[model samples]
Target: MWRVWLLLVTLLGAAGAQEGKVGPQKKPSPQNAPSGAPPGAKNPCESPVLDVTPKPPPTAVLDRESASNLARSMSRLLAHQQERSAQDRAGALAPSAAALAKKVIDENNGIHAVGVGLPQINLGLLHFRHHVVIFQNNNTAYLEHYWKALALSWNHTSGVWVPPFLECNPHSTEIWLHGFAIALTVEKQRAVAGIFRPLRLDQCDSMMAKLFGGPHRCDEETTKCVSEEGRGFRRAGYRCECRDGFYNPGAPPSWRGFPGEIVELDPNDVHRCTACPEQCNTCNSAGKCGVQRDPLVRGALLATQAACMLITVMMAAIVFKQRKCKTIASGMWTILETILLGTFLLYSTVVVRFFEPSVEQCLVEPWFRELGFVVCYGAIILKLYRHLIEFRTRKAHRWVVKDVDLLKYLLAMVVAVLCYLAAFTASSLNFIREQYKLVRTEETSSGQLFLACKPLWWDYVTEAGEMLILVFGIHLSYASRNAFTQFQERRFLCAAICVEAIVSGVFYVLRAFYVTTLHPDYMYLAYFVRSQLTSTVVILLIFTPKLWYQHKQVRSLAQEFSCRLPVDAFRAGEAGALTADGDVAELNLADMNPEDIRAELKRLYTQLEVLRNKTLRADNPHISKRRGGRKVAHRRFSLQKKGSREKVRRLVSLP
Candidate 1:
């Protein structure tokens, strides 16, 4: 093996030395000369073209030309047959087998066959191919001289020019593979199949063990890698520098490494490196790469968050103050306030996701969002239930009970929220994968990695939930359409729900096909947070102010009752009136709630009706003819006038 390698190297050296000498120049013919040149002048083409100011050797490739020239030269060194003749055996060796294999595999780095060849040379074949094979053939001298002549023409210094091909006999079986149909002997056949074949396989295994760190590895097979790793081959011009699947994540701008070393190829794992900026896919270490949100998209997301937060705080304050005004916190109406507050908070958080929505955020956001809607809509359903109950009782002329049964409603709301949460969880919301997109601008260039959620279909839960609420609210409104003024509270609730449903439904339909033009958060804000915007308006313009006014009316009614009949004088008036004396008695109406006040009004109306009937009977013509009747008529008129004046005072004092 040593002798064969030494002989090949010595031949290559002699060939290089001979090719370096300049050959005799050719004189140009008169007709072949340039039109402006003198006759018998040497053509400029006679001399080799040279660059006066040649650039330095490029550290990295800028184009395909240099690489292409290198490939062509390498191809010539490892001879590829374009056409095979009938004399050429199917499995045949080329001239200078040992030198050819060494030059093709070692110098070219395992790139053997190229350009749509019938058979691709496996890299593992390098192990067996490099073995020294001694052939007793007459064409041995011719093969050696042919290789020597071809090597002479190769340029070793500049390494940019194409190499010339060497011609060979087509019928030379003595120089081909061990087996041949014509002139090859059986001795050569036995040497190849018996001695060379097994030796080559063993050598191939050994080489694979050295190159891939394992004997079982095949050069054609790909390897596994992590999230930041990859594997590739050299058939595509990658010489273990940065393989095809690998990328350079440049160092941070603060790195003090060599100027061009900000990002360098990994020595171990081809794809593993650290150069990308925080929250970025790839960068030049000088700056981060992030996708900039469009101005309109950014503004909308921020505005929605700010607005929702403000509204949430305002609603909570109003609800708190309303409760402070002697209003029951554990009542059906309080549920609506709770719903408004929950929705506001949910919306505010939803808008924040537009900024940097990660996998964790996407996974958990829907749960809170669905829970908020459930609470709000569930409260509406309970309110409708309470309203219907009251409406039925009042129509039947039965005493209407105003008990809120707050615990029952709250339990029901919790159950509904849990059900929504369960449904959302069952839907299996998740972040599928991250997409690294390159961002380029006049100011900077970078790459951004965006995490998009999977199964975007679950967002319809909100729409379905809201639609159900609206349906029930509309039903309740219809049920109470002809309700008396005493049940006017239903009207405000009906109007509020209608407005909320319409606004939300319109936005929901719009968002069905509306894609974010700049950032994903824009769609998130429009879809998730916009519903709360409608809820806020309903609370501000409809719910809160109306409830505040009702509270004020109740306070005014209580104040007027206290002023008319003081607690200190109530006992004296009651005792005197019962003794049948001519003194008018003020009623004992101390500490009366709104419900008690309504009862008092009903009693007053009954008394006024009785008094009005007696006065009408006393004014009849038959009664006036009798002297006693005329006296009765005067007495009744006096009582009627007093009752009318009392009724007028009470009516004037009502809220």
Candidate 2:
């Protein structure tokens, strides 16, 4: 056995070695033959003369083909070289340059560089020759012009043109200082025009002065300048100009604040800010221009919205639970509510991300927006169905179709159908097709469509209809509550419905008016408070002791009233009772004793017996009437005796 195992192991080892040596199979190489050889020429391994070159073609043909091939090869080689050079250049720039490039690309696929240090007015020109070639087939001229002009003003670059500075020393203080001066000058110009622009002058000078005595002025004009009484650059006929924060000594006295300090443009003069022709605030805002906009702001807003939705959903759940609102039908309502909230959040986020009101403002197509409305409204309709079911049944715990107000429900259904039809009519088949086209063309993983479409009023209308359905349906539910419960239930339901309606209505109206009314910042808090109130109302209505106590009191009162009714009176004037000329005397309880009660009982028993006998006999109506007449005679006698005795007893008691 040992030998057998050893043999097997040895064989396995050998197999593994052979596998390793062989590695993976290699692909076969093409066979080579001498140029101009016959199609069936012998393989080079089989013939010694198989490698000979073919005779050259005629000079003219050879030259033409050679020249063409050479030109094509050179073109390809040069293209590759240029691509590598461009990549290398990009790699060599600071990481900020790449970010700036990406920003430019995002803006318009254009590129420019702004100086980073003091006096950072230097603008680095990007070679547009390559961009021109690359975007020749695309519309890129506008992009180039936009970036060039923006960079020129932003970087405070001198002259209308950008200069190539491949060997420019980025760390040079002189260049930075000059850039700073240019930036200051540009800021001063913008400030005069009422544009709230940031001052980019390096604070290093002041900071360093505090650390180390400020260095001598490096600029030629400022180097020789000293204190006003001292003989320096000013003594030699050189005028000294202070930095942005410092005032010129010889200038007419101005206020003691920083001479060139930039201030925010007042709203009154907002129109004068030339940078933003019609909207000065747009340019002056933090993310508007000359300031870094935090990407995290969008993310944070989205998170806040998500949190708000979560809270709202939780509140809704609490409300439903507290209301003791049960029913298999309500499950659908919960699901629809969840879907609505989720979709709302998703839609809002998408809008924030891709909806650039100024540039790509029209990308969200009308049909897509309409679809969003449909989804929201559909949720509302579902909620309405739940309310209708609950109300019509008059049962909170179980769903019954018969309980719903069929008329109102049918009306709602009709409205819903009409809304759906409207949505269908307004549907953008073309937009959907375009979305499909985008999917096929773009390499994106998100399956969302309508990224590039424009929003329309129809979308808002669909949403409005949906909200109305929900509001009305809730109202119906409140109305269906028992009259006793109506006050509180109606108030609560009305408040909730009103809130939803008002918010939704206002949102639509603002959207219609193109106003930014909804802010993500406030959504969470608003929804949270609303949800809490709704939950509280639901809880109070569902678990209030007053309702239960009232119900019990009502039942007790009914029983007491029923117990007090005269049982004998109900039996009076019947066929079994005394009937003299079809008139019956009233019973006197004063004379009635245990015997009388017994007698009355016996009479009733006897009458019941006679009726049973008659029934068994299958008597016709006349026969039955005769039998009943006999029983009536017996009851009359007994009642007369009882009444007389009762009168005697009453007289005795009175005396």
Candidate 3:
């Protein structure tokens, strides 16, 4: 124990005697060497004093930075620990003490140094090379020897960094300053007090100041300095490791902040770890929440459309074969085909929805979807309206509106829709918006997107327009309710309109909710159902009945009379058979044969003189006595004539 103290104190004395410095001298003085009892001895300390001069000025700044006591704090800690352990062991167990000492030295990586008097500090491990500056405010006022210098007195037995300076015993103020460099004694190992280093920035912290020269800095007050995970350097970094679910994005490495070094940690920041994107709990990077396109449903939509188109084609072919047959009794066969064409367009709209939204898809989808609806529904209304006109007219007039004329009405509706879409498109009223929320993360959510025809500001206008179309369809259905057709087309059309209304209502109510909560796959399913169901209803209820009736060779779907004309009535149009009776013929009100009704009307013309006399007498109040009798006769004749004429005209002008 005495020898251990003697060896360390002798080396420390040699450093000051040789250069009046704090650290070990560069050259050992053989004359100053005390007679050692050991055979093999050599100096392990580097230069006794160090020189460090600041150049240019500290210019570094940080988002969060301030002066700190890392150097003094860490150095005091190491010195206290080492000195205590040294006294505890009394230098008896060399290997164990050496191991303990090395472990303690390695604990402080970003080593800093400062003397009791120096105002400034230096960076790096507390080596003899760095010097503290105690002089007044001047960069070059550093007289290297006047400032506190770190002395490394290498105890050969314990291969570890010891305290900067130590005093063997208590001393007065006079001897304290001189003995501050190093203390020597020829006594057994005993407890020694470390020279007090002021809270002034130590060498490591000053090194930090030098490193903090740019536009970035670390907050040491809130920071923590610790050993780097795998390194032997003292004080690896100043940081607080993020908890389980959080992460520090773009944070500086452990080495950079405490000691001012750069390593990988996001963007090299010095703040506490921020939470990762909410989607990623178990991992790093953005989470997996994203829009998942409903491909399966979209594929089904395409297939359904293709099948419908095929069915539409076949129906068109079958309907074409029955073109001239009034029994299939849709308005004009050509107009009905035009309706089929419209249905084909509607079905095609389903296929177009198979792709994701983009400029082309956005534009094309609305165009196809709305235009198809306009054409199909418009054609239906026009067909009904043409028949409706006949009933809407006064008794004296007949409406034989041409098929092409009815088409013009349909074309006008289509043109109106096209203009509406064009105006919206030109104004760029459409934009992609989140259509459905696919996932919900605490911080951020993900959803599917789509191009709305009109943004929120004007979307109601579009909705209103759509509502009006359905209202008009309902109105048309009602107005034509009493206008009888051979094939109960009114009922089926009303059914189709009802279906569309239901779909529209449901879509309107659920749209807002599903847009935020439904999955994309379900969204596609809703789209397919809404698009196809109306068309399906129209096809199955209206057209399918026609197809079935036409297949069965039935001429008229009208329930009232047998479809065939009586042979007598058929011959009535061929000869003067219809006019054989110059007298008014009794009318069979149930007769659907055109010639039968015409024959009756022609016979009524032959009684025009008699019918006129009765009508005049009945309408004249002056002849009150016989007016009742004449009115009864006139009423009977007038009803017969009107009914006969209506039947004849309707049957003859059916196309």
Candidate 4:
């Protein structure tokens, strides 16, 4: 029996040595064996705890009862032996596995170990699989399966928590290797071992369901998440690798990277990833591009449209009022008002153009904006010059014909300039439409059509021309500031021009920079603000005064016509009665003909002259006696003297 026992031990030892040559071997200590598993029974193929390989058929036959008894005895013996070996192997691996788990946990910052899921299991000849539950500092848990764990090492680069024993495919599915796993430095030698694969979407869903007690949708597969299944793994997880046009909207607002940069699937989150808006390729929680204009821009555009409409109405009223004032020839002023109205219309169009982008509107809006600005300013400058002429000549009629002829020339020149600019603009826009139709970035959802244009040199050229004219107008107004007939008018005109020029210049500069940095929506808002400000300032300066003056004139006319003549005053023959200081009080001339008015005024003047003569006679009666020494001489001299005095006053007051 002793000899047989010695031979069995020797054969078992030799078999273990032979198996060790295929891959690295781990010798489990008997003292450290687990309580349940027998000492050398952890890996049956490695140690041959029962040597259960089938013998060459059955040797001999016997009675049924005898054969059954023998089979039962052999089974008991094998079970007892296997149990002892498993205990031994468990004891041997326990300390090492514990140390290894600790080392891994320590290497991975400060994650806590939530106990081992399964003790290390040598699936094949040499390779072992370790199941460890790790809790991240954030309270999130991960079930990590370590393959070829005996030789595990921390990979400092790549930031992946890959075991050192695995030779990871960097360019392939992260930490994966193809072909049969050959013995590398005595590690696992299985057909496909030492490979790590993430859980598949379904597996992750199952795992998440198990953890949180609810069904969970897994993150979709992405390019960065590509990986092959190894022995028992699939590629999927909570790691953020969002699909194209799909973003993790639940990510932190401060996270400005591409959509899936740092997707968090904490318990608080509803969905890990979401699709961007139809018009967006990538977006934030608000479904807006990173550089997109805010909602305030739309509000501002609406406001601009409202202001343009209101100003348009006011301008139209002013023009109508000026037309009604037939006493004042408002031909040039009418042209100016018309130009302002056109400017407001252009502003309205520009505002709407941004609200909805159409190729046709884009083609014409730029021309409209530029031409309206030039012509509007040109008309205003012309009005200023015309006013200066009237002031210098001091005769409104002197420049009437000249102004009419000059206005026609001005209109013709404006038309010519507009035609030139329109041609240039058309050519440039056509080129843009033909040549640059597609967006440069493949990820951008905006169509190939150009939404906006950089100010070309020719664009600046036209702007510079406009600026030169505006500056010239400013210079002329400043130079003839004192020459203006009304200082108030000059002040308002200069102020409006200065405001428009400054505001427009600033807007241009800001828009140039904003267009380059921000999306077109923001630039649209800036344009709206600029257009409204320019039109408003112009209207306030030019049209407001005219509207106010017309209002006052209308009120005066209404008051004049509404006045009533008392019957007592009419009976006293005071049709145009003179007050205490020889001033004629207003009389109600309602329904009176021009002839009746002329006759009444003449009679009143005769009465006033007779009263004046009576007063003079009372004051200096001696002069009447001495003058010419005759009644005819005195009367003729007094009449001549009064006529000479009226002529002197008229000549002195001539400006």
TM-score of each: 0.39, 0.27, 0.41, 0.42
Prediction RMSDs, each to the true structure:
25.8, 30.2, 28.0, 29.0
What is the TM-score (0 to 1) of candidate 3? 0.41
Q: How many backbone clashes does candidate 3 have?
A: 25
RMSD of 4: 29.0
Give the range of the ten consecutive residues with the poorest summed lDDT in model 4.
135-144
lDDT (C-alpha) at residue 576 in model 4: 45
Candidate 4 ranges beyond 4 A from true positions: 1-244, 247-300, 303-307, 310-314, 326-333, 356-362, 393-403, 437-451, 484-488, 519-521, 553-568, 576-655
Candidate 2 wrong stretches, greater than 4 Å: 1-296, 309-399, 402-453, 467-471, 474-490, 515-655
Model 4's alpha-carbon lDDT is 0.45
Worst 10 residues of 3 by lDDT: 169-178
- Ranked by lDDT, the better of candidates 1 and 3 is 3
Candidate 2: RMSD to truth: 30.2
Residue-level lDDT of model 4, residues 1-655, one tens digit each, is 2232223323322212222222222334444333322232432122211111111112112112222232233223333334345346434443443444344334432221212211122211222233332211111100112322212221111112222111221112222111111111112111111222222222233322321223323344431232222322222323334566666655675643332212333545433456766765555554554334456867767775877777677767756665634222343456656567557755765555655444455556656766676567766676667667655543322232365655686678668877886787677667777884322211124422224443456657766776787788898687667663432566666777787778877876775555555455655666666766777767767666665655565555445534554434543346444455322343445555655655564465569978996786675644444433233323333346557988999999999
Superior by lDDT: candidate 1 or candidate 2: 1
If ranked by lDDT, best first, what sequence of candidates would result?
3, 4, 1, 2
Instruction: Pick the lDDT winner.
Output: 3
Q: Candidate 3, residue 86: CA error in Å? A: 97
